[model samples]
Target: MNYIALSYWHLAIASILILANGMISLWFRLGLEKTLAINVVRMLVQLSLIGFVLKFIFVQTSPLWTIALAVIMVLVAGREVAARLTTRLAGWWSYGIGTTTMFFISISTTLLAVAFVISPEPWFAPRYVLPLLGMVLGNTLSGISLGLETLITTLKRERTAIEARIALGHRRFEAIEQPVRQSLKTGMMPIINAMAASGIVSLPGMMTGQIMAGADPVEATKYQILIMFLIGGATATGTLLAVIASAFRLTDERARLRLDRLENAGSKNV
Candidate 1:
């Protein structure tokens, strides 16, 4: 079966939903109408641009282009992770941690999947690699952001308690262990919930798209399951690395808590 093409008229008609949402926000004086409108516009523009770029990359099917695009995705995701943090490590530490963790986990997982699970002809096929990497990088980005933000916020709020533990002869790692664990848990919660609720509660986006594009339901289900597993693994690995790295950056060699390293130490403005 051929995929149904959506024309400009169809897109315009579909955009009514967003307009209605913005109108509702405006009527309620929620102050979100502008944000909603802007986000809608941004989403359209960004997705359209990416769609074109991806089309080109798919046509070219060059390994260099694929690798460059993957690197760009990781860099952007890392910046997003850094931006989401309420309190960030000084200088490039936050970006470095996020980028390094995301790069390692996303690349490793993507390679494993492509090489063993879903080996295409060229092995570096843009179609498979790009989409898979995008999913992994996107999930890992969110997980790392959530974990890092939680760790920073918790450390700021629980400084007294952490210091008390430290004064009681506990190591820095010991003092911050609870917060680190909590942060990791918080980061993983979204993926866990999605995994638990998949299929029964809702059809995931990928599966829905695949089914719409005329893929077999059983095949789509299998692909969705693989993607979910990859996402989960990437999220956990990235979150753990990011949270632990940030935790270490929060302290000194003397096991002293250094909240000073954070730019906005006790603020939840993020």
Candidate 2:
């Protein structure tokens, strides 16, 4: 398969669409032009930097570098998960739960895939591990953010009913059981819908990228299938961990509701 080369000039041309969107934003008084511009720049800088970093890592093929980068990515992603919460837990708990979940789920799942499934020359191959880890973490992060947000927001809204349940002899987990279930459902819905729509409604990003880069369609599909399953599994597990941990944090050994653990929902610290 032949690969077509793209230069920086091509990217400049492609960026015209973003410029047009910014223009439209300004014209419509959408107040999104500045945001659009800033985000475009951020995307360029971040992607460019990562490209260089990945190049260096791939050349070195060092487990140490790969593991270090993975840790950094997990920490950054964890902080981002916390930032997405409208009502976050006070202090480090806001980010700690999600971060820990992402690290365990993403790293473990990626390693299992690389070791048993793909089994690249080196199990810790940066090229395979980093991208797979990124995808797993990204999906897991989404599910967790949604689950935690829904759980927290719902707890605040349904505080009275939950407390009533508690007063009526229900345990902490029992009182908030409905909201927890709802949160889990909300968190898993995206991957569920995605799985449903993957072949017919859309081609997944990884599959599409593989095809574009001249991989055999069926081969790309097999990889995509593996990825989807991994993502679904990771997302569900991570979301469950985050929601359950949060629930525990929201209650004490005495089984009392502890809303004090949460920061204000409206005043986003980010």
Q: What lDDT would each prediction earn against the true structure?
A: 0.90, 0.91
In order of appearance, the predictions have TM-scores of 0.93, 0.93
- Report the C-alpha lDDT of model 1 over 174-241, residue by residue, as the tens digit: 99998999999999999999988999998998899999999999999999999999999999989999
Worst 10-residue lDDT window for candidate 2 reads 261-270
Q: In model 2, which runs have C-alpha deviations exceeding 4 angstroms?
A: 19-34, 265-270
Q: Which ten residues in a row have the lowest lDDT in candidate 1?
A: 261-270
Write the residue-wise lDDT of candidate 2 on 1-270 in tens digits. 667888999988988877889888889899998878787888899999999999999999999999999999999889889988878998789788988998899988998899889999887899999999999989999999999999999999999999999999998789999999999999999999999999999999999988988999999999999999899999999999999999999999888999999886446553
Report clashes for each candidate as comma-separated counts: 0, 0
| TM-score quality measure for candidate 2 | 0.93
